[model samples]
Target: MLSPRESATRERVSLDGLWRFALDPEGRGRSERWWTDELPGDVEVPVPASFNAVLPGRESHDHIGDVWYQRVVRVPRGWDGERIVLRLDAATHRAVVWVSDTQVAEHEGGYTPFEADISEQVRAGEPVRVTVVVNTELHWDSIPPGFVQELEDGRLLQQYFQDFFNYAGLNRSVWLYVTPRTHVDDVTVATTGIDGDTGTIDYRVAVAGDGGHPVRVVVRDAGGAEVARADGAEGTVRIEGVQPWRPGAGYLYTLEVAVLGADGEVVDVYPQPFGVRTVAVDGTRFLINGEPFYFTGFGKHEDFPVHGRGFDPAAMVHDFHLLRWIGANSFRTSHYPYDEAFLDYADRHGVVVMDETAAVGLNLDTGAGVLNQAGPMETYSDSTIDARTQETHRQAIRELIARDKNHPCVVLWSIANEPDTVSPAARPYFEPLVAETRRLDPTRPVAFANFLKATPDLDVISDLFDVLLLNRYYGWYVQTGDLVAAERLLEGELREWAERGKPIVMTEYGADTQPGLHSMLREPWSEEFQIDLLAMYHRVFDRIDAVVGEHIWNFADFATRAGISRVDGNKKGIFTRDRRPKSSAQALRQRWHGTEEPQPDTTRNVQQDPQQDLQGDVPQGVQQPARQA
Candidate 1:
C-alpha cells in the first residue's frame, strides 16, 4: 500500500482527468462487452471524483447499479522490463478492470487502494485502452452495508442505515507506476525505545521478486544530514539527542530504503517519512510520547457540494488550517480511513488522528427515526449482517493498519463507529475484530465509538478496547431543548463510565444550528442553542477525570439521504457547509484557547420548566446513525 513515487529506479504517471463515462442502470455493461468497444453514450467524466455529482440530471445524481469509465494510456518507453502497476487509489463499492478485451483485476473495497499488474497487457511506448466498471451496490455482507428496493415506477432506490449519502465512483486518484522487478514491496518502521535523549528505531524491509539483493537503510534529519544507517533487510539504528515528534511541533526522519544490484548500483529506492512517537493508554489517561494528551477536534467527513466524497487538495489544506485556527489537536477519520495526503499533512503539522475502519452500519435497528429501538432480529446472525459482513470488516481493518501503521499522526485504531455493542451477540462478533487490530499493530491502542444505546450499564464489549469512545447526544437527541436535564444525564453517564477506569473520549457531541436563526430562548436549531449545548457538554467534560477528548459530531454540514429529518443536510456543523464560522465555532475557539467567554444574555428573564415536552418542536429521533465505512 506504499504510495507511488519517482526514484532513480521508479517512475509514476497519473491516470487521472477525463474518461469516457456511461451509466448502466440494468447492470448490463459487463455482459454487453462495453470494454471491447466505445461506450454507447458520448458522455465524459473526470477521474478522482464521484461520478454522482459530475453528471447531469437528478437521475445521474441518484444513480444506482453499474457505471463504466474508459480511457487510453500510453506506457512509458523506459518501462520495458520494469514491473508496471495500474493502481486505483479508490473505486467505490466494487470495481472490475480490463485492458481492452481481457479482464485484469477486481477489487471490492471503496476506501482503500488496489492495483493490477498491467505489464503483460500493454507494450512499452504504446497506447492501451483501460476500461473500468464500478458498481454502487451494497448488501448485508458488504462493509457499510445497504440495500436496494425497487419502487412501483420500476426504479431502484439505494437505501442505507448510515447517515451520510452514498456518493460513489472513482473518488480518488489513479496511477501507473513502475518499479524494478526486484523492488521494495513494503517498509515498516517502529520507535522501539526512548531513553532520555537517545531513541531506538527498528525497521523491516520486504522485497519482492527473486533476488538476494543487499538492502541498505539510511535515516536523514530535516537538514538532509545522515542521522543513522543500517545494512541488511532488518536492523535497529540508534540516534543520540533524538527529537521526539510532539503535538503542534512535528519532526520527521526520512528512511530511504534501497536494494543494491550485484555491481553495488542502486536497483530500487523508496523513501518513507516517519516520526518518532509512542502512544499508550495508562489507566484513565491517553498518552502520546508518554505524556497525557487531550483531543479537541471534530469527527469529519470527506464531503462537499459538488465533489461529494471526492478528494480535494485545496479543501484538505484549508481544513488543517482551520484545525490550527480553532486550537484543536486531533480528529477521527470517522467511519473510514481518509486519503494519504491528509495523513502526510498531519505528519508535518503534528495533528493526531484516530484512524477508523469502514465498519459502520453494523446495527440493524438504527435508522432516521429509530434511536433506542431494538428489533427481534440479531445484527450478527446469518439472516442479517452475518459472518460474511464480519469478514469484510476484518479485511478493512487489515488494509487500514497495513496502509496507515507507519504514520505517527495515527495514535489510535477505531475498529468501528457506534456498532451494536449493546447486544449480547456483539461480544463474539467484535472480540476477534478487536484482537485482529491489536495483532496487526500492537504499537497503537484499539477502540470503537460506543452507540448511545450501549450505555455504561448495558454495553458488553467495552472491556475489549483500550479506550472507550462515546458518541453521546444529550441536549440534542436525548433531552431536547433541556440543557439542565441534559447536563445531569451526561454527568451521571460519565460517572458510571468512570467506574471502568479507562480513558473516555467523547468522539461526538453537538447540536444542529441554522446559521441565521436566532432566539433569546434556548431553542433547538438556533445559534444560541448550539452554543449553550456545547457549553453544557464542556462543563460535564471538565468535571469528569476520565474525559480525555471531545470531537464534535461534524466539522461542517454534509449531505445525507433525503428525508424529513434532514433540512437540506445535516446542520450540526459549528461552521456552515461552506466553512463559514457559526457562533458556536468562535465560542469553541474561546473555550479551547482559554480566552474570554461570550457572555450570556441576561436582559430577559427566561422561565425554566423542567417538565416541558419539546419533542414535538424538534425532528423526532432525528439523530446521526451509528457510523460505517
Candidate 2:
C-alpha cells in the first residue's frame, strides 16, 4: 500500500498518542453499540504499541478476545474538498472501524496496512468519535494458525505452534491524511537493466478517480538535481553514470510523480525513494548485480521489552547500528513483514532483506520437539488446515509482494517459515503459491524456510523454489551438547543438498545461550557453547559448495509462551533483549570483520545437470523425523 505522505497538495496528521482503551472479554462491545457512546471503565493506552505488555495483571497480558479503542478527531477545515482518509498501519488479526455511528471499514490480515475514505462520514470542522474494535483470536483458517481453548475454571487460553509471543492490539501507527479528489494512488518503480555506464528505470503511476489530467514523473539525485524526466503514466527513464547501490554503501534516487489539472496547476504529488539494484539466482549461486553475494546476518523479529511487537524508532535505529557494527549485511523478517519505517532505513543504509509473510507454523506434527514419538500427520487435509487456510496464505503472499515489491533491499521473498513440506499433500498446496509469487513479481526469486523434519531427502517441495532456506538446529535440538556429532550430521545433510544444485542458505542455526553463563568445557545453554556451535557450522558451510549464506536464528532474545523448554524467554540471541552484546557477539564480529579468515569461494564448478529435472512425481512413504521445536 502507498504510505501517507505530505506535500504541496497533500496533508497528514499522526494519531499516535494516548487513546482510551478497554477490554471486551465477553465480545459484547458490538452488541452494546460502543462506537456511539464512550467506552466503560476505559484506561489510557498508547497507539503504535501492543497493549499486552503495558497493561497490568496476567488477565490483561494474556487476553484472548476483543478490545476497544476510542478517540475523537477533528477534520482540518482547509481540507474541505479533498478526499480524507483514515489509515491504520496495522491491526492484529482482525479489525472493524467506525466514525461516530457509521461503520467505515473492516479488514483481515494483521501485518499489512488498510484504510477507509471517511470524507462523507463527518463535517470538515466537526469533531467525530472514532471507535475501533480489534480481535486477537486466531484459528485454523488464519495465517500462522492457532486455537483458543477454554479451561475448567472458564478462563480462555491461546495456543499457537510458533516460538514467539502473539502480541496483539494496534501495533503500528494511525494517520489521517488528505489527497486531491483525483490524486496519485500508487507508483511502482523497477530497475529494468544496468548497462556499461547507464541504468534504466521503468515506472507505472496509477491515479484514482476520473482524471484524464496529465501525469509527470521526475527523477532526482541525492543533491536534489533532476537527472531524468518522463511525461506519461508509464514509461522508462535512463540515467548515465548511475551510482549503483551496493552492500554497506547505499545511494537512493527519488522518483517524484505528480498529477496536473487542466489549468496547469499541480493537483497531487508523491515522492518515492528507490535504489537501483538487481537480484538473481543462478545455479548454486545467488547473484546481486551479476556478482556472487553471500548473506551474513540474522533472522530478526519486531520485538522489544515494553512495546512487544510495536514500532519503536529508537530501537529500530539501534538495531541497524548494531548490525553495521557487527559487519553484517542482511536480515530476514523472520515470520512477517515489518513496519514501513524500518524498510525506509534499510533503503538508505543498504541492508539486504528477505521479506517474508506471516505463514509460520503450518505444520501440525512438528510443534513440540523434533525427536519425540509421533507419526506424520496430514496437515493439508480437509478437516484441519483446509482450503480456507490456503486461501488466507495466498492472500498473505499477495499483500506481502504488493507492499514490498518496490524495495531494493528486499532481494528475496520468503513465502513461509517451517512448513510441513514432507507430506505428499503439501506438494499440491504450495505449488501454486510459489507460482503465484513469481507471477506477481518476476524480478526476485522466492523461497520458504524449510523445517528440520523435512530433510533434503524427504522434502517434497524443495525443488519448487529458486533458493533453499534451511532452518537447522543440530547442535541444540538434535545432538545436544555434542558439537562433533552436530558438525558431522550437518555436513552430511549439506552434501545431500549439494546434488540439487540450488543456492543453499542456512537461514537459522544457533543454540540458546544465557548471558554470563560460562563453562570451560563445551556445554549447552552457555556462552562458550553458543560460540563454538556457530564456529562449527561456519566450518561446515565453507566446505559445502552450494552453501552461500548463513543467518543465525535470532538477533536478540525475545518473549514466547510459558513452557518448561524456555526460561523466561528464548535465550538464542547473540545480544540480550535490552541490546547488550554477549560474548558471542565479539566472536561474530571477529569472524565477519576480517580479523578471522574469510569464507572460501565455493561457487565455482557447481552447475545443475541439464538432464535432471524435478518435475516427476514426488517420492512417497518417506518416514518423517520426530518433532522438535
Kindly report which residue pairs in candidate 1 clash with one another: 358-629, 360-627, 360-628, 360-629
Candidate 2 per-residue lDDT, tens place, 47-148, comes to 989999879788789898899999998888988888999999999988999999999999888899899999999778888889999999888899988777
Q: Write down the lDDT of every candidate, Cα atoms only.
A: 0.85, 0.86
Which lDDT tens digits does candidate 1 get at residues 160-261? 668888889999999999998899999999877778888898999999987699999999887879998999999998888889888877789899999989
* The best candidate in terms of lDDT: 2
Please report how far candidate 1 places residue 489 from its true position, in Å.
Answer: 0.4
Q: Candidate 2: where are CA atoms >4 Å away?
A: 368-377, 596-629
| Residue 544, model 2: Cα distance from true site in angstroms | 1.6
lDDT for model 1, please: 0.85
RMSD value for candidate 2: 9.6
